[model samples]
Target: MAPKPTSSIRSFASSDRFLAEIATDARRPGYVLAGDESFLYQRCRAGVLAELAPPDQRDFCLHDLDLAEVPIFDVLDRAQTPSLMVPFQVLFVRGLKTLYGRGQKKEEFAAIDAYFRRPNPSALIIFVADHLSIPTDLRRMDMQDKERFERIRETLGDWCGIVELSRVDEGDAARWLAAEAVTRNTQIHPDAARELVDALGADMMLIASEFEKLALYAQGKQLFLIPPQHDQAQPVADIPTPTITLGDVETMVLAAKQRSLYELTDAISAKDRPRALALLHGLLNASDGGEDSAIGHLYMLARTFRQMLIILEKNVRDSRAIWSVLWHGFRMPPFAAEDLIRQARRYKSRADLTRALRLIARADLEIRSSPPDKRLVLERLILALASEPKPAASGSFHQFAIDL
Candidate 1:
């Protein structure tokens, strides 16, 4: 017997499964979408809206409410009342965290339980708990989010179906990129898909947006086709398929930003503190969230340092060798292979790279603690990483000095 295909072996994304469920139209009276993955959240929302509220009858059938502005009782009342203009109603409720705020929500829970007992046959309610962030791997979910997830299960899960919208895995994201390209009458080169996913850190929204630009770029490219040879009666012509290459991604996507990231790493590796700080400021200024994006910058920094550690441990000397060392979904873009190898060589040993990762982790914790000045924390981290290691002391204190 032949082996099973990869798609068959791997579980489908939660968002995809939810979309399929929406197509059947055999949904429950209410549901709770649990996660902060906006990409998957939007996908599920679009699927629900497309099924429940067609463009022609959207205004009459669809309703958007927030618990922060409107009370749950009013929302339940809206759901209970039937609309004269439309046959069915769909309510999207946001700010679910407000329900679990201070004090016991006995009245609110009672109202919800009573409403669900005899729900209107013509209406559907969807509660969006976007405040909880769910990672691709459930085992690694944050403790607070895990608690929040369980709380919902204990309460709302009794009356509503819970659909998790977790982050997409890198491999799944890349496969989706290829399949999505095919839907656009274009083929995405495997390398291009990998590069795109790695570059965006498997952010589906960014991948989807960049893929649109890539598809358009591929479609608009001038095709060079050879004329079919003259035949006696009729000629068979071969049509060429448009393909999105890696070069296209590097040209169209946020390649400049990635390049700046590499440049920052380069400065750090070379022990140039001034240049590294300058590059850091440039990165922050160019970002949409300014200092708020410090976490994202720290994430990328940690990833690059980890890559350098692997390169150092494997003794990878060139780009060709680097591929064999770095596994798929963890590899960097081809353009940075040589630069990374050079940077990795600058470190005296794996200890140096490990120290860098440790410093990054400290900075991450500080930023998460809601520091008054996130920029200063990042600057201190950079300064620490770019500084030369202290010379080892002779005697019993040598190990202690190295630990410091």
Candidate 2:
């Protein structure tokens, strides 16, 4: 049997692992860095460039091209050329969609696909998608684009490794913040890290930038970087600094900014009326988009409750099983998978979630219809969602089974 096309693609969650793979493997000629998330892709590209050439040699060894501006033939020419100052020439191509996106340049793509078969070993050719050309949900991509996406995937699947550099989820983002803090010679309390992640919502670039600012804040307060003690047990005598408290995180990272609407979703799931109200108020008052923001919250809440309804109706118990199904079907944040399962129990039947969806749809319509007091309408909806425990006149749904 012919090998499965996906078998050759490698996905990496850790920046360390991805960088290490490219650094250690000198023979891998090309990589397709897919996904719309630019921050992760940039980091991976930076690692490859750093490995391929030093700053001084980059002028001579690195070639950057955007398919939108330059032709594929030009890109191929650059990739084929060897570096004069370094062992490897780095060829970076951005906007892979220009080639594969609608208005198919069959001849150009055919040439590029052929090159992937035997790319120049002396140059690292990387094709990157800076933003979602095709839908992040591949199923949402039109049949034409989906076929184009699959063709590209299969063509480069064996010849070049495919790296999906997408955003990390809430849990992974929190863990990354903590790990990054350690690297910066600082410490973040678990709660503080979680707060940062919740407020930021997995924008890795923003999270990293905030960490730099936090490091300075800690240093200025003299709360980080304890003095070395020669008498300490180990030869390395530097003492650990104090942990960054949640308060510090709130003051530094959040700075009274409106929390993400995701918190409101959690609040509604947990049925915390007061918290949900407060979050809704903050989102309405502080969020920039006003009515648009309100609609976004409704959409998110509706979508989340709908997913929970599925889990409840199916009575999916094991976390692994739930995640496996959700991973392929819906894109829930991995960190919140367990939370969703737990919250599913609050629903007595599918009717509750279905009613909630109706309420959200109603709210969306009201906002669009130009209500005199839009916030008032949303607040009332929140109260109703908080107060209602189960759907009225509902069909039977399997009870959520809690493991002992």
Candidate 3:
């Protein structure tokens, strides 16, 4: 009915407008810049401070905070910095949740609560969290994400307005491509632009940056013409004469898919089935052409499984978390810790994995064992592995559960 808000606000204070208001308030310089991601916080701080700060501190205070390690209190408290004569100081407590992860002796929440009470007025205290889940207690905040806009309105009880990023549909993508073409002085074929948007999805930053790059490469080639090197003539006298061609897009797509596939293989070897599956899916979709070579695909899959067997055999004895596979064996995607736990449970024991490996081995052999039918063999192997359940590894295994 009204408008959708981009991020959730656990309280009115979490709203960006209120954050700006905090900067505007000469009376109240101290405020918490807490939000899901530090990106918004950093941007907000920089913009507001640029308006208010004197020339020097403006640049220094905006981004210098070491959010990953600074103890919340050490920054939040009205403590002295190396220099004091400075007119005003802003305390940016970046990545506030990382504090909770420190070991026993370093626990500092009690001190943090105390620091929150008397923050420095001269300094605007801003805390940024990339996601609510970053905080040990913040995950619960997501339930409020759906009702985020309304909740902010209610929570702020009178806080601030959010400059939200709009969610776009297919049609919107088209409109954006046309309007953007004129702005950057580059002509984008509707199809090429749409393809780029869909592949990139809805990340605003990605869309903006990529568009600019496209404009740069597309410069002078307004009609999306083939380059001079190709020796292709203009299809239409009216077509603006593009310096770049769809061929360039095709090449990039192939390169991305190849890298993504190899990455998938690495994930599989780590016994990180979930990451492995995600990488496979990404590779499948990232390319314009699907599965360039069936024999090549089969080879990759077989190698992945073979590597997995080696890691599993050693890990069965070491019994370390599955993640150690990344460091000890081939590296996979940047999988999260929770994914490792979930993927681990699916491998009931080394035997189940061994069985899966055999199917893949046979598939690989089938491909080279004869003339081909390689595509069918590879697909069959994927299905065989896909059929097996990969429950989240609860780290619940006893006596090397290898039924094989």
Candidate 4:
């Protein structure tokens, strides 16, 4: 038979994977149970420790007993016996379905009932886990999953309480870096710290290791200086996006006005006028139901032209940042922001910019005010913006404000 296709979900080899692997003829040297992903890595170590130790600090180890076939009296003796040869012993049985609902299998009611009745007293029972996914098969099984979970909690009694593991959220990454910097006495600016997050791209371990590098590099170096050695890492965090800049915000604003005129121009050059205008109409609707949006669109076109002039004047090679600036303001549609900068310069002319902005202003007015033929008005606006005239110092900014 062909092998089952692998799961497409992209979490760290998650607890669910571990659980799915448990007792499906993949048993370890000992028995294994399915568990939760959220608590898997964390509880595994401590659970293993507990399973290896004596339950009551009595001088005994579960290893001394035949895990497969120890007699009741012999096992009882082992638990009661104080010994120099053996220390505390814990029995290990995993896969508590109470903590983790059965995913594609039937609930092991009989197994659970038997296990609870004669639980090896030496074992420090544990339920390790990740995230939960209710299995499709269980929906047809009539398993009262919640009730079973409650039953397990009752069976465990005071012997076990749920222990939570800490996972970091996006908001905490910057603060974490700042703390790391302080610990190492390195002056990591907030932007630099944020860049660290970007570099690691939400990989917490990677972020942690990089922050450690900051500490390591700081040693034997001047306390007042951060060495240039650590600057070469091309991690996204180093991209200097500490806070949302005004330019970045402006791109989003322009994008909301309609699709970016700069991008549309390429389509127009390819004689794809309809496609170009569609983008314009989309931007036109973004400004909300107001005349200000019309005006805002014009200013946005002017601004893009302004940026283009600046780039040309400065003779800047950093085209990527220019595009990021556009993505932030004009709200470029979702795609990689890296390539759009060079693209922005392609359909460039001051005249085109002026016309596009003027078109946006007109669309904003028609959409907002008492204008007839809304659809036709939009189509006209799209054409005007997509194939705007060359600049001649005729830019209009009639105040397009979004009423919050």
- State the local distance difference test value for candidate 3: 0.48
After superposing candidate 3 on the true structure, give the runs of residues whose Cα lies further than 4 Å from its correct spot: 1-23, 26-68, 78-85, 98-121, 131-183, 187-194, 204-209, 220-404
Cα lDDT tens digits, model 3, 1-404, are 11112233322223445444544553343333434433344445555565556666655544346547665555644434433556666655555446534564233645544543554545555444333422223433445443443433343222213333223334455566566566555666766765565555433345556666666766634534544554455354545634334444444433223445555544653556667666655544443323345555655555555545555565533233444554633533222223334343445566766666667666666756663454455545555565544443468553222121
In candidate 3, residue 141 scores what lDDT? 43
- Candidate 2 RMSD computed on C-alpha atoms after optimal superposition onto the true structure: 11.5
TM-score of each: 0.64, 0.56, 0.43, 0.30
TM-score of candidate 2 against the unseen true structure: 0.56
Best-fitting candidate, measured by lDDT?
1
RMSD of each: 12.5, 11.5, 11.7, 20.4
Model 1, residue 164: C-alpha shift (Å): 0.6
Per-residue error for 100 in candidate 1, Å, reads 0.8
Which regions of candidate 1 are displaced past 4 Å? Answer: 1-12, 223-239, 255-257, 260-264, 271-404
Model 2 misplaced regions, further than 4 Å: 1-17, 133-149, 223-240, 260-404
Which has the greatest TM-score? 1
Two-way lDDT contest, 3 vs 4, winner: 3
| Tens-digit lDDT track of model 4 for 368-398 | 7757655566566555544435333435444
lDDT of each: 0.83, 0.68, 0.48, 0.43
In model 4, which regions exceed 4 Å deviation? 1-86, 89-122, 131-160, 164-167, 178-188, 220-404
Model 1 agreement with the true structure over 1-404: per-residue lDDT tens digits: 11112242122455556666655756788989998777777767877877778888988899999999999999999999999999999999999999999989999999999999999989999999999988888998889999999999999888898998888888888888777776788999999998888888677788888999989888777243434464536633675677899878877787536888999999999999999999888887666544558988999899999999999999999887898889987888767899999999999887778778878988899999988888888888888888886756767542422333
